[model samples]
Target: MTEQPVPAPGMFTLVLHTHLPWLAHHGRWPVGEEWLYQSWAAAYLPLLRVLQTLAAEDRSHLVTLGMTPVVTAQLDDPYCLTGMHHWLANWELRGREAATRRSGADTGYTEPEALRAFGIREQAEARLALEDFEVSWRHGASPLLRGLIDTETIELLGGPLSHPFQPLLNPRLREFALREGLADAHARFAHTPRGIWAPECAYAPGMENGYAAAGVTHFMVDGPSLHGDTSLGRPVSGTDVIAFGRDLRVSYRVWSPKSGYPGHAAYRDFHTYDHVTGLKPARVTGRNVPSQDKAPYDPERADQAIDAHVADFVEVVRRRLVSESERIGRPAHVVAAFDTELFGHWWYEGPVWLERVLRALPEAGVPVGTLSDAIDGGFIGAPVDLPPSSWGSGKDWQVWSGDRVADLVALNTEVVDTALATVDKALAQAAVGSAWSPRDAVADQILRETLLTVSSDWPFMVSKDTAAEYARYRAHLHAHATREIADALAAGRREHAERLADGWNRADGLFGALDARRFPR
Candidate 1:
């Protein structure tokens, strides 16, 4: 018999999940709205420029971008828009201050005020970001995002309103959030999303029914979530909805929890900051070296590193494609999903590396496209009963539901149970003879706080000890907000309840489309 040729090697899809918890009216210092503005400046803005540039060259379906509804609400909010503008101006102001700060001759900074150049660079970046924000993002992200869609440059993924961990959530609330989130996508993009990033790539058996109910056709999960067999998108629970697993082997090449391209000696040192000037003046000279001893960052060397890494990444993808196809006895699909903030935020040279890798892949004969394209190109495999999983530590739900966060697990369940019951009871009373109505303001606020209380960020932060204090504070704050409103509703204090709800809405006021009456009975 004649030897059979392995057809097309494979394809690759890149998914970037963009999200930040609500921070419009939050604090500004060590953490709060600063998180929002920093990411907006460092990651989202620069990354958009790269994608827009690629689109100008007729690059279509380049990547799948997920912006949770909460992020959408913040981006479009008048309050956040005003705050971001001021934040950009402050950044520029800081850059000027850095220009005046001189380093001691005793320090290794060789030249007097060697930070002057870094300060100048910061000023230029701030000015560029200011212009970008004022002209392009002033109104909202939708218009700018729409430009990408209009040019056929990307696919957008939508998720639940607040990024709650679904497996631990009440099914009714889960469905409600799912449907409302898609509705949000329609409002922003003029198209109802058929796919979601599934809030941390969290999945559980039978969750597909809710996805199918909400009209979601596809979602993402981690590699181990599918038993490490991630060469194709698998259907879930015999439904048309597909679950695509991230290829960790390929993804870790650019970024992983422990090591990646960002750790290169040539890259700007993320941890070494010039305290006075608030700038990173050093490069990654050595992992164990003190911040002051690190060498000054040289842009030229970083550029070389970016090119070499991009070439290496392109080769990795090409080899993975050919080898995986041969092993699977068919064409394969390699999906690499990552946080959008990783580029430019955590990894300074990431956006450049991203553009280079994206451009290089196709030239190297390793195809690249969005998840949607992979599906249309026939990357679907047999249906699966995917176990409960997440993209968190250990590729399991332990990060959100582990011994460390057992208190949070209890708190989340408590708030959800109370808020749902209270809302249901309030609605029933209002339907019969109460002063308030089913779409009452107090009820909406209760649900809002409840949802915020269960955000995956809180527990994950707690588990990882990353700002665990702030995480606990936020969780308790929201839970208390829910309790206050629920107490007022129970006491039949309509006027007091409305006032309480109004006050809460001032800070947490988002999702105007979230109708309390429409919530499941």
Candidate 2:
């Protein structure tokens, strides 16, 4: 058989999104705040530290962090900041208690030796805070993100205030959300974002105009969204917006929902629990085993798997880059995008796998660059309009507003509209530059309420059934804030608006520069 020659030369781009919804003022004990804290510590903080370290070494990460407005708001929020400090302290206490349990000889497990070993390991892990808490979370806005952006180590991309699945939203609402989100990004991050990450990677037929109006030039879509056979960015039907499709072949090599690398037997079991102590204690068993019965993680075995996967992924990327660049006689870009949480939140060894991949890519001579660089270079051409689609189930919006989440979407729409209207009236009556105007105070509070209300986390929490109570509480808190601000404005109680705005700002410390002019002219 005649051998097929190599294809065109191309590049590889990696985009990682970092976001988490408002968890402060909601849940903090046992389940609620713990989830938030762990993610902050495990994935977000560590990821940032790693990136920063890379930057110091003059290593170009070629990564983008999509700080959704809602997430940024929460991160910058004073309430969240204070809450996180307390949460970190509580974690340290937990670690201490775990250490005591390990040493006191009071753990009455049937297998004392095994129980002792587990306790000791757990205690050690708990006490180790990776980086100092203050240094990890630091001031308002993720310290890591703020540092990276300020240093130009990463190109920051912004998203809607609450990451609302815009494609399904009313066009006006979508426009409003995008406008507010981008403006908020500029105010908080102190940089204008050139690109955006459509919440859930969701796009609709005419959403490009919404993006364009908001000043976003590019976004990402699923591989299947491009008819399952392409990897280039293309235009929607009638706009200049560029929609970059994921290279599923390469992406699936790392994550593919059911068939992804996370399902590997050597990986930690994400859903197993200890029958004795009620904590997650099982290891990753065979791939086909029920999650409840997987074996404990074997670091040795997991390391082996990581090495194999990294090698396989490098080859996949290398061949694709070389052949694509050769095939089209122009450098082609193969973008592999994935959720940031998948690295450590869902896949236990994901962080390790990631480190391996990052280190291995350069060694393999496969040049890695950010999506923006690819666009800046000749790898991608003129912008194209994208069709309505998401990287969700069936490459649509089922996961976000599916049968189970549809009701939540309706509720979100009404609440967001109600909040926006209240803010509009307040802005009208307030002095634009006055720090103490009643109307302006109300306007800002209303904006805060709008943000907390639109957090996509609420619907996601309810849909996932992880922490429904916390979700419900947060949604209601925003609703209440919105209603109270509106009532104050209607009654011409500028005093009340001023007072509430102060308190709300203290509580909702996000979007420090939320200007009301972003609304329609």
Candidate 3:
């Protein structure tokens, strides 16, 4: 009799984390609402379109998606919807200007043909994006996401409000944030997520208890957090919650410091911009090449590169799964996690590559499923004690709490303590009441500002030196608001507190349903 062929090794799950700071009414250019609109138009819209198409074709749950409550709130906010629509219209106008204008040395586009081509492409993209927005996203993103979840096109992972680095938050505050964040999701989509892409994938020794208490069944961590053995999801000691490690070998294939698919010579250079169009039009000809020296981006060449990279990635997954399964004598699990924004926002062709990879993986005999599906499919391993870790530099908290951001760490602590104490005191003073009232607004604003102040983005910005000034300014701005509101509440100046809260709410308002009273004294 012929020997039975060994079944192809375990499955592959692609986890894409979608997050951004609350940017509805924040600044407009450089690092504000523009960031939100650009990503919305490029990444979210296109990625969702891909998933929806796959779902229609009966290929659902091809990837796991993580959308933090903060980002969800912004996506659903009416103000943001209107703003994004207007921004798309403006983008089309900018494209028109680029086509009509002449390029100079300062504009980075040396070739008129290249500039005109980029302009036409931009105009077409903007018009199509606007049409999509008006047809599908005019109401809000919640409905679109809800339909995807209902169809099981993706498993949604919710995160804490404002994406705080959980390891450093006070335990009570941590629990509060997690509970509230989950509640926000349920309110929006009518489904509570069981798995979360922890902000920064940061974890501490005792967070398992928090996960258990919050009813989370699983979460993602760095591969090194599991000592490089990512063949299965391990249960945290003494808890039913599972911790899935990202397979860095597969993930870094797409993005890494030294090498990544995005750096291909034919791919659009993320850093090189056409000043005339305010858009990128050059290929990454060679590393460290001057912007002017780069070659024009060719769509046909980039399409070829994308196809080649997708094949390479599928093979990487197959080899990893087969090797790990043989070593362990069972089907192994491989998860490739990446930030959702990296797709269309950072790498212009990422969404296309993702759609192709998802379709190609199963054809290559490697099945694609969500992290939850992996656990249910018997990829769970023996319980283990997880170390304190994050998916940051050195696989630790250095990116958020290193010496480079010591000042931010100190500032966060002060702001959180003050806000929690003041909110508790104010709640106690108020007479017992029903769900929400004016008495709760001060405490609500305090928590909102506090959450904003402790966002992981601040330290990340400081460490990376990317918009460090804006990050610092934002941190201090929220901290200042938190302190002022807390002080007003403490001084029994209810009117003053209301005014301060109102101004801050109008400026940085998100999570309108947040109740500060849920926090412990």
Candidate 4:
């Protein structure tokens, strides 16, 4: 195996991106609930629990977590909180069923011939903590998480609401997304963020000005964005916004495009479900599965694989740190960043790997530190203007606003612009008024409608081809609100505006204190 570089004694940066799209007041049950519950149970809770445990042990793992305003709105929304309550109860029911089947309870839901199938599904649900889903989401936006932020256990990063792939978006509207996003973060967390995840680690050459305007000093980019040719901590546009490029060489050691440790032969296959039922039941030893066949999952084999991979990764990071420190005469921090969902939500054993890795890092003499620490400790080098790129294919916007969703870009552009103009007009008018009339409420709804309408999820869903129908429906719903508010004002229907505002408030209540002035004129 090729040797990895080692950083000096005190240089390592770890960024964990925490993001979930707005699923509030959108829908419940079936696929929508699945998206929320699965993530909540598998990734968010386990990750937080792990962090809390570490913190309790007085282990301060310096990490960066990005919770977009859109995700925060959903996490704190009353509707979502209620839906999560029901969803958790149902999830526990699923776990009970799985447990009963595994115990051969003769619950009238099992067959002797399919004992193996029942066993696998039971194991899957149990590992998922399906029974704890309610408690998980309930405790997900944990006081402990807030503690981490307040105590500086981790550096909190911010991002655009709904994570619009900004480089491909219109300039003025992208500016709106960035500014409002930062303001929303400030309102929610009561602290301004020093950095951002840059929405998919996507950056365009001139995007630094927007970051500067929003008071963000640092943002991330894919390593390849720097032509796969330079070190981290480069400056962009002669501004204070520092562009930190991901070290793909080190990152891919843990997560690769095609053949990461997650895809090891002994690991559980993400695809290949059993034919008898929809349960996954196998491991892939190689890229050697038929186009259409169910594979059996092996937990015992997967556990062994996790151990091996964790050991190798820890050593790799250690070696990298040591070698780099030796070369530079200073500790060289190796930043390993990945989607937080990778742990358990997508890669089934991801959470386990994380626990092991976190524990191993300290034992192996490689400390985990946040990006802010790296910047503050003078580990930073000269900054450079990041090229327009993303963590998407070729680090481009193709994954988000690609040919498949070609029309959404222009449609969203017009709607967002019109909505912004409406807000500007309303706020300007309301400012000069003597009293808060009923029209103010109508104007408030218009602002809410505009933000929700401008969510980047619609175009993203269309591009990804997942839940495209629901995406279109949501886009239209918000668009309708924006249009109706315009019509209500144009017709001078004072009573109509009040009625519509009341109805809109009832239907889409959220962050009612938003100020439309955050958007650039």
Best by TM-score: 3
Residue lDDT tens for model 4, 35-69: 77567656776777777677777777457887777
Backbone clashes, each candidate: 0, 21, 0, 26
lDDT of 1: 0.87
Candidate 2 per-residue lDDT over residues 1-521, each given as its tens digit: 86643333566777778777755555566565566666765676556656777778777745777777766766666666777677656655554444344332322223333334544565565455434556555676555576687776677878877677776665655677777778778777668788888787887777777777677887877877776534466756667667777888888888876687877777767776443342333456776677534555566788898899999988899888776666666677888888888877777677777767877787667767766776677565544545567776667666677777676677677766776676666555564677555425566667667657766677777777877777767777887777777777778886886787777766665666555555552
Off by over 4 Å in 1: 1-8, 104-112, 433-438
User: Best-fitting candidate, measured by lDDT?
Assistant: 3
Instruction: Please give, for residues 1-521, the per-residue lDDT of candidate 3 as tens digits.
Output: 76643446798999999998877666888998999999998899999899988889998878899999988888888889889889899889987776666654678668767777777888998899889889999778899999999999999999888999999998878988899999999999999999999999999998998999999999999999999998899999889999999999999999976789998999998898877667888899898899888998899999999999999998899899999999999999999999999999999999999889888888778888999899889999999898989998899999999999999999999998888788777776673564553548878989989999999998998998988998998999999999998898888898999999999999877888898767866
lDDT of 3 at 85: 86
What's the best-to-worst order under TM-score? 3, 1, 4, 2
lDDT of 1 by residue, 1-521 (tens): 86643333879888999998877777886788888888888898898999999999988889899989988898899988888899899999878766666663443444335577767778888999999888888778888898897777989999999999999999989988898889988988898878899998998899998999888899999999889999999999889999999999999988888899999999998887766555677889888888767887888999999999998887787788888899989989999889999999888899999888878877777778888888899999888899989999888889999999999999999999999999999888778865556468888899889889999899989999988999999999999999998988888887898898999988898888787887989
Question: Which ten residues in a row are the worst by lDDT in model 1?
Answer: 104-113
Per-model CA lDDT versus the true structure: 0.87, 0.68, 0.89, 0.69
TM-score, candidate number 4: 0.85
